[model samples]
Target: MSMNTFPIIRVVTKLLIPYILLFALYVQFHGDYGPGGGFQAGVILAAALTLYGLVFGLEAAKRVAPPKLMQRLMALGVLIYAGTGVATMLMGGNFLDYNHLTHDVWPQVLPSGQHLGIFLVELGVGVTVTAVMTMIFYTFAGRQHIT
Candidate 1:
């Protein structure tokens, strides 16, 4: 029942996964300018990886993105999100405030740090979501039957 047994599926999946990943990145970065955002991007990224797992098998997917790595990424995303808030606070602004981010360093930039803050927060959210979804898929797929 190996995926490689079917050459067509294997080749098609291999060709498609890269495009999926590229689109995910596009969604992630372009979210600020358009309709897409962190949540959507995260789901897209997760879906790509999930597709990879489905086509390649659970073990292969795990080898590529280990559970431990995903767990760490989840924590890291939270830290990035929270740290942005903390940074704003340290800059003498309210929690989650973006204006303070640029006032002290680059006051000349129009729109200030708001956009930057939003981007960072969104990135954090995307990372967290991608990791969680992949982890969940791995857990459910890896379960063994208890007879």
Candidate 2:
């Protein structure tokens, strides 16, 4: 079956992708205090893109998220994750020690640097995972099957 065979499916997929992405964000942001995190959020994000690809066809998906873009995103995410650790080290603490991420300007009523550090790290993880999974899907989808 080809993409044109299911117009309803395509329409439904289009309708759902935004909500899926939104939910992914929710999981990412609430991860530190709840059941979700970078990994779960990442998977959800990737799933949304994957659903788009399955519904709209692989080429369309690739156009939406090119391989070069995915590669850069993967690198950037890793850098963000590692940079947090390096920053802490430079701040006179061990790697990934969030205590060193503090700033005096932060209000007493607000959460501390630990929360900020975790958020950054999780953001990185989510980015990397999304790119990796999307790339993986593209890789397999782009391959020519031997008949």
Candidate 3:
């Protein structure tokens, strides 16, 4: 069965994307004080990107974010979060311990750097999740048969 690509879908997709991104950012940053961290943000971002893929088609989505690049980016995001923990451990502290970030800077610098690190990790998670979701949608959305 074929389905119509309606104008409403385009309208909704365009209007909702920015809000989705904003909400994801809020969830990512506010997680330290409460809940809803990288995972939730990633999901939201992925959902938004998937909608874009659905409305726009696989080629457009791939143009926006290629599949191979998405795979590497997702792995990089995981590695970054893991790397920070490993670096802390190598410094003889517990995993994710901020104090290991720097020596000369002391208490303030370490916390600041840690906060920045967390933000970068969150951003990476968001980007990778979005790209991967788009790629998955593209793969599953069906292909035309060649004559």
How many clashes (backbone N, Cα, C below 3 Å) per candidate? 0, 0, 0
- Candidate 1 per-residue lDDT, tens place, 1-147, comes to 137577888899999999999999999999988888889999999998898888889988989899999989989889999999999999899999998888446556544688889998999999999999999999988888679
Top model number, TM-score: 2
- The 0-to-1 C-alpha lDDT of every candidate, in the order given, reads 0.89, 0.90, 0.70
Off-target runs (Cα >4 Å) in candidate 3 are 1-5, 102-132, 142-147
**Candidate 2 lDDT by residue in tens digits, 1-147:** 137579899889889999999999999999988889999999999999899888888888888989999989989999999999999999889999989887663667546789888999999999999999999998888888899
CA error at residue 3 for candidate 1, angstroms: 2.6
Lowest lDDT 10-mer window, candidate 1?
Answer: 103-112
Q: Give the higher-TM-score candidate: 2 or 3.
A: 2
Model 2 error, position 122 (Å): 0.5
Q: Per-residue error at 45 for model 1, in Å?
A: 0.7
My TM-score estimates for the predictions, one after another, are 0.91, 0.92, 0.72
Best by lDDT: 2
